[model samples]
Target: MIGSRVKYRHLHTFVEVARLKSVVKAADSLNISQPAVTKTIRELEELLGVALFERDGRGIRITRPGDVFLRHAAASLTALRQGVDSVSQELLDNVPPVRIGALPTVSTRIMPRAMTLFLEERTASRIKIVTGENAVLLEQLRVGELDLVVGRLAAPEKMAGFSFEHLYSEQVLFTVRAGHPLLGGGSVFAGLAAYPVLMPTRGSIIRPVVEQFLIANGVAALPTQVETVSDAFGRAFVRQSDAIWIISSGVVAGDIAAGMLASLPIDTSETKGPVGLTLRTDAPPSLPLSILIQTIRQAAGEVLPV
Candidate 1:
């Protein structure tokens, strides 16, 4: 059992070191000496009655207990920060801000419209938007750092502690520049392997489906591949090169509608996935959060392609 003697500083230091995998880097990030960082970790380990990390050569590996503790420690720190922010807002602005996490797909297509409509109605409201992969966003939502997350459904294991509300369904598509050579090719997949490809990052929920689709199509490996989830990079790269981009249909909906990009004619129904809202089961929504959720539903109805 962990003792109450552990300090927040200890947990903070431990999390930093675990994240960086180097005590010196953690020390520099925290603006403290390396020895002080080590002493804090030691104290926390003693209090918990478990070794948190193991030093091997020049790097450190978090022990099993450390991995478990890191989750709780990070959650605690996030909760504390939220509490401070809430109190500060209540004291000064008399209104608490709503924090939201959105995956790139929704951020690019739906959020801009939703945010505009929401702000138009509630002009004084404050909303903070964070963009990241599903796992990172869900973790933040779980820990109360975010009021909710809007994105594709995560794998079953990652959805363990949260509740999801289905918003809509989305499919992955293979897209290219408007006038790419593949446009009139008799064998699209055959010629695809000759050009560079852009794939979703590993953390994306649709990445595995994208890989499976490629395998099913008999393209064993792309000649060249770039993995990313940045909409700006994707837009620029595809417009400037012959690289094929496999991504959520919603992300490039505007580009497709505007004829800036073209979706391949290949059927991709097998890659369909649910996009939704993820929330902590234990927490009730604040007024601002509740309002935003309604606005999102409305905006999705308006913006998401049929």
Candidate 2:
């Protein structure tokens, strides 16, 4: 029978090597000898009974098993760091920050108002918001890296082990710079292929929605296009060039109102979905986190027709 053998050193070394993609570089980054790093990885692989990394020509690539373990391993490290900080005198003396995961579409519209209100009420509290694709945010939430996530609800399979609170319904919209050539179109969808198209990134929450809308409109493919999830990039790119940006309504609501952009006359009700907050079912939020959630709800009420 194997005795207790796994340790923090093993996981730490393995993650660094996987991240840096080189044993030597990981050793340098971890301030250890290459031999020690290699030995640690070997030990971890033995304990797990699976090869985590395999040589890919000169470099190394993580095996399917290693890729699977990487997510949990990194999450464990993040949890450990937060756990240590939670009890530290320095952290205990001060309020812990509310770590949040935000979607790009929500960040531009709802986050600023919610965060402003949250900070105003909890003057001593700090906030750290990490924004990314829906899958990434949901994974982070499930693994305890984030206190809560605010955005559109993801697909059910990816939404395992979390509770979503529906706040409002938001639609997807097509927009371009005011008075663009696509404006006087017979059918904007027909004209879309001629202009440069900006689409939601492949992994983002709205990517499938945008793609489905386009496909249904006979825009199955385009010659010139960019796929991104950056609201700032989309805003700038669409305004500067004859680019048609398909994005959530809230992201460009302010711009459309100010005449910096105009929404194409298209009925896209099918792309509408519920925007809301998501929290881990097993993990209860801290007091500051709860307060922040409340403030966010209040802000949403004011800004949206909730």
Worst 10 residues of 1 by lDDT: 88-97
- After superposition, the stretches of candidate 2 with alpha carbons farther than 4 Å from their true spots are 1-89, 92-95
| Backbone clash count, each prediction separately | 0, 0
lDDT of 2 by residue, 19-76 (tens): 9999999999999999999999999999999999999999999999999999988998
TM-score of each: 0.68, 0.68
Candidate 1 lDDT, 1-306, residue by residue in tens: 364687889988998999999999999999999999999999998898899999888788999999999999999999989999898777758666789999888998888988988887764678999998888888888888898999988889888878999889999999999999989867888988889999998977788999899899898988799999888899999999999999898888889999999998889999998999999889999877888898899998887643
For model 2 the TM-score comes to: 0.68
Quick one: best lDDT, which candidate? 1
Pairs of residues at least 3 apart in sequence or in different chains that clash in candidate 2? none
- The lDDT for every candidate, in the order shown, is 0.89, 0.88
Residue 81 deviation, candidate 1, in Å? 31
